[model samples]
Target chain A: MLKNVHFGPSVLPFLLVLPQIIVTLVFFIWPASQALYQSVLLEDAFGLKTEFVWFRNFEELLSDPLYWDSFKITIVFSFLVAFLSMSFALALAIFSDRVIKGSGAYRTLLIWPYAVAPVTAGALWVFMFNPTLGIVSYALSALGYEWNHQLNGGEAMALVVMASAWKQVAYNFLFFLAGLQSISKSLIEAAAIDGAGPMRRTIDIILPLLSPTTFFLLVINIVYAFFETFGVIHVVTAGGPAGATNILVYKVFSDGFVGLDLGGSAAQSVILMIIVISLTVVQFKYVEKRVAY
Target chain B: MIENRPLLTIFSHIMLILGVVVIAFPIWIMFVAASHPEIRMTQVPLPMLPGGQFFENLDIALNRGMSGMDGNGVGYMMLNSLAMAMMIAVGKIAISLLSAFAIVYFRFPFRMFFFWMIFVTLMLPVEVRILPTYEVVANLGMLDSYWGLSIPLIASATATFMFRQVFLTIPDEMLEAARIDGAGPMRFFWDILIPMSRTNIAALFVILFIYGWNQYLWPLLITSEPEMFTVVMGIKQMLEAAEQAPQWNVIMMTALLAMLPPVCVVIFMQSLFVKGLTETEK
Candidate 1:
């Protein structure tokens, strides 16, 4: 990755890299290693007693139905988030790309949500859907439908998914718009001359050409829903209504910090690390393939 | 664009307007909520329009803060968030620039080792390892401090990689010319390289500033004291307190203030933000 003509090796380079190296070691590597080590040891809540029990935490986690439920919830949550956000973004991006005039204005109106934090988005949505005071809930009630996310697991899941997906649409839209822009206009023009309608051209040409962007956004959105939506869950549902919205990341937090199950939390952390590593590997591989193309 | 179909153009515009409205609806609701009085907010049909109480609520939320909480006003929390975001963005950009320069310029021992070490940080987000990291920070005596809030989160692999990519694109002749002119490494880095990559640095600063400002769980874990609470995290505290006293006006006002800066940055620095986002992800 270095340049062909590089400076000579010296002590300065070490000093230059030292700050990054120190932070990575102290914050990232050390704590990660501690998680691995703690996974193999079972300790009491007070840290007074400890027993080296290799793989027991993992065994218990694998066998625990609640952990499995959380796992399933995470899978459902991420998939729904990725699907909802990506589809909405793709549609918006397509329309934004199509319009010849005021496209920039539309984009400006759309992309600011990228800067809004997940928690803030959560607060906004939760406020709008508050059971007693929320206008949306009032509307739903007017339509003869009950709306109480605090008491309904399904509603809780839906609320969180909407909030998480809402924040992510801006990011997916940018990438999709970029992808749409990169396609040669001559191809579309030729198809139009060949009597292809707009819908037919989009299905046969645009979507296929934008598959790479779609795939990339899919992975990124899943990872985001997995890790970054913690604030949304924390603010909106807090994994409430019988743990319906409690994803794996929140579970690790509750199990470790609230339940005082250190070994179990460490095990969950190790599992999450594996998931992130695999997703990163897949992303890098696809990126390399894209570069090769 | 291939053919000017008037009806299709009209349809596209309609769909876009609808999409924009759907996206902006919650924000509109937040503003309306923020503008109304507390009693008006608690009513079944929350006010759909902005009320006269906007400045009055703003004054309360910004200065007096919410009651029954830690009493740190939104103004103070916004200052803390600004400091934390600035430190994180500047610190990440500074350290990453140095490390990237080193990796690209000097062939030192364990260069690949250090590179991979930084790369590993990407796979282990703070969420996964929250407990142990919290323990480490607590042990280091950095809790309830800005250094604690910013330093641990500042070791950014994406920024390092982005700078490295930018450095790779720089012409070798610049470095050769600088060397011929007897300019040392740091001098060349400061003068030539920094100037060339100014756009990239600015773009990355925008992305990292939002990232730092939006951080929730890390700040929530460490900053227990009210004075150290960030505005984004303070919104959560306000939400928790809303269950008891239900000060929806002040709480919504605080939420509005919390999201305003980053939103403004993204809107104003739209190009740089887009550049930073695309380049860093790549």
Candidate 2:
């Protein structure tokens, strides 16, 4: 989309674009190519020699039970995060939209959590649920149940999900509120003139109309859960309590950086790249075809 | 206004209040934890109310290191984070502005190719290619440096695409007016485009600052030296140490310190923050 009446091209345009191009190539393009290249090659433990083993890394990963289990964990984690955060945000947005007083204050109070780093969010959750000293755990014990994330995988998963979802609520709330605000007042008035209750109108009109925002947020949230929650997992569980919370992104880091499995980690990276590319495609399709982007 | 719905209004207030409480709960707890003495913080059913040890803990957390790690004070880490965030925010905006200007103004060979190259970067986040990227950073001899912390992350496509979007919306009349005055391309960009995109640039500055400050994994990967540890990454080390010593007050203080600047930025520049976030991300 260039301007029709524009200056002639020369060294100026190249100079303008050179910095971004250079950074992108050195950091983004080269590393991605390296990941792709290393995914197929098997190198010695000491880094002396390399062998090109076509698809063995992929085959081994597919066959490995832990990898498969983490795949399931990623799906379950992303699902819970998306569902919980979206529903919370939608509910809040609905109520926020219905309010006549103190709405801006409520919005401000709710949206500031978006500023909290995920790791800090995780740490906050960890403190609140710290089995011995945590208030929540103490409250749970008083309620005739025990809470200890360090030894229980289910509890660990719940802790992380809460932390991740908590951090996301602010973001989702902003979008959902914007989506709610953008709906025409006439539509709701028309629904009300027909004597439809608020719930009915929301369920019938608002929900359906908000689906595009919903779908867009669903993809955005899932992508967030898949990639951005590394810090959360790292800070909260380290994929521990017996590898219960090991999502794919964390696995890529631990495998490549910690476990020293070059081929395997690179393969995981390749797989992750594929996932991201597909998600980006989905997002672009929505923006191009459905959403008002 | 359509209908009074007094009952619904009350329910709405209740829901909004509950939403605010739930959203603020964890942060409140973190603040209270940061205030109490370490011994009190370790007590069961930790104090729901804040204690007077806040300034004391803040003093220790700022000057001395946390419970476990040594030599990387919260003060230094915060400074490092500020530097990194400022660099990343400025670098991304500067480069993106220049490129967006070029893309929208001039028709050149490989223009589409360059646009595609920037677009493709959106799909390749640092998480996917951590190892090779780390290797690249190491080879560049930038590891544990501020440049190392900020530069590779600057290679992202979001800022470029955002500036491109911003530039496209600037009316052609502005450029035409400037050109009829015999202004050069750079002259027009500096005089007209810069002022026109000032708000967008400021909003983006806020978002990118937060993004750069909240960065965890990249810095965790590249910076092995304790002195180079950022405040956010340093929290992990402190937490690990807490498992043994349980310095909840100090650790939580660091956590609060780590998050304060970004949170303050959001609260202060709210409309701009929301504009930047919704426009760029969605």
Top candidate (TM-score): 1
lDDT of 2 by residue, A1-293 (tens): 88767788688998999999999999999999999999999998999999999999999999999999999999999999999999999999999998878888888898888888999999999989988989899999999999999999999999999999999999999999999998899999999999989989999999999998999999999999999999999999999888999999999999998989999999999999999999999998897766553
Q: What residue runs in model 1 are displaced by over 4 Å at the alpha carbon?
A: none
lDDT of 1 at A163: 93
Clashing pairs in 2: none
In candidate 1 chain B, where is summed lDDT lowest over 10 consecutive residues? B64-73
Predicted complex 1: DockQ: 0.88
Taking the tens digit of each residue's C-alpha lDDT, what string does model 2 give over B1-282?
A: 578889999988988888888889888999999899878976777899999999999998999876556744689889999999999999999999999899989999999999999989999999999999999999999999999999898865777888788778888888889989999999999999899889999999999999999999999999998889899987898888877788989989999999899999999999999999987874
Provide TM-scores for the models.
0.99, 0.98
DockQ of each: 0.88, 0.84
Best by DockQ: 1
Across A57-93, the per-residue lDDT of candidate 1 in tens digits comes to 9999999999999999999999999999999999999
